[model samples]
Target: MPRGFYTEGSLARLSREFDVFGPLSSDPEPWMTAELDQHAAAVCESITRDAGAVTLQNLSSYLQGFVDGCRERGWRSDSAGYDWETLRLLAVCRLAKEHGFVR
Candidate 1:
């Protein structure tokens, strides 16, 4: 599938657009929310501590677990679930890119 098929533009655009929908309150889906935050934090910490070794590929590999987890939670056929996962991953990747983990 082509990129942006999920929405229309970039993940950043989708994130901004999602905000108009409403605030994302805490839900029972820990794997989709808090788990994503924790994973992002851990990835950032690792990247900061070892910038030389933490590449985008490394970050991507780590993120795959989160993606898989999200899929298990409900990302398969749900647009909302896909959006949440995409938003979380984009935020994490953006941070990694800023820290030089990605080009």
Candidate 2:
């Protein structure tokens, strides 16, 4: 179980409830880790396909929210611990760059 699993789950839930990326009719937790992996791949593809279309603002907001949410959940932001939140943000950033969301 990767640490980002929790963050991915939470983001998926948020996306579903708010229709951020449209409706997600699947179990987010069980699929979170996999989803993150897929998201990273998608981003890379999008970058190679069309760099101009990639949107970093939205991705940054999402990552910021994820970090804040994890902090609210009692995860320390200044440590190298293998906590769920920390891992999630790290993965999110990686994906964001792969997708051309971040530079």
Candidate 3:
């Protein structure tokens, strides 16, 4: 992700449940690794927030589409690395679920 492409404002609501780490920068330094994990955890938590209310079959289907979208967008590329891609995918999944665009 580009610097400032995702801002603290985008994650304001998530701050209550998880640390609001800024998005990956254009030339992200190694120090950002910790924040990346935090961001991913937040996204995962948010995406799974309604897990109990959602059917396993539906959740699995949604998850497949979510991961496929990420891969199609190159969010899962080796260039982005495992951690970065993990966070990116989780974040997108969370946002999609929030908007009712995904399960």
Candidate 4:
């Protein structure tokens, strides 16, 4: 699938567009929404410290390069129950890109 497929909209909107509508389908599952704000704050701090800022100009390359680097650490963001920090990082990035790559 195209990268746009992942970042075009909130999950619910996508599901609806594809004819997969239901109450259980939404922007994020309840568990993620509960902690997303905190995770976003942490990601902002981390991105700021490491690369100054994660702007649209660099978001794609940053994500690509970060994924490469993560391979060394097992790249288990989607593994089993999921690693919260890694999962949050991706969630945060997806949301950032979804929102037009806001800095």
Best-to-worst lDDT order: 1, 4, 2, 3
Residue 82, model 1: Cα distance from true site in angstroms: 8.9
lDDT of each: 0.51, 0.47, 0.44, 0.49
* Candidate 3 vs candidate 4, lDDT winner: 4
TM-scores vs. true structure, each candidate: 0.41, 0.44, 0.31, 0.49
- The sequence of per-residue lDDT tens digits that candidate 4 reaches over residues 1-103 is 1122232344334333222221213476677565666766666676678778766544454445555566666654334343554455445555554556442
Best-fitting candidate, scored by lDDT: 1
Q: After superposition, how far is residue 80 of candidate 3 from its true place, in Å?
A: 6.6
Question: How many times do residue backbones clash in model 1?
Answer: 0
> Which candidate do you rate higher for TM-score, 2 or 3?
2
lDDT for model 1, please: 0.51
Could you give candidate 3's per-residue lDDT for residues 1-103 as a string of tens digits? 2222222222223222222233322334565555555764565575468564443344444456655676677653333333655455444434444555433
Model 2: worst 10 consecutive residues (lDDT sum): 16-25
Q: Highest TM-score: which candidate?
A: 4
The TM-score measured for candidate 1 stands at 0.41
Error of 2 at 64 (Å): 1.5
**Cα misplacement distance, residue 44 of candidate 3 (Å):** 3.2
Q: Which regions of candidate 4 fall more than 4 Å away from where they truly are?
A: 1-25, 76-80
Write model 2 residue lDDT over 1-103, tens digit each, in one string.
Answer: 2222333344334333222221123334645657556655554455546444445555555566656776787865445343454435545555554554334
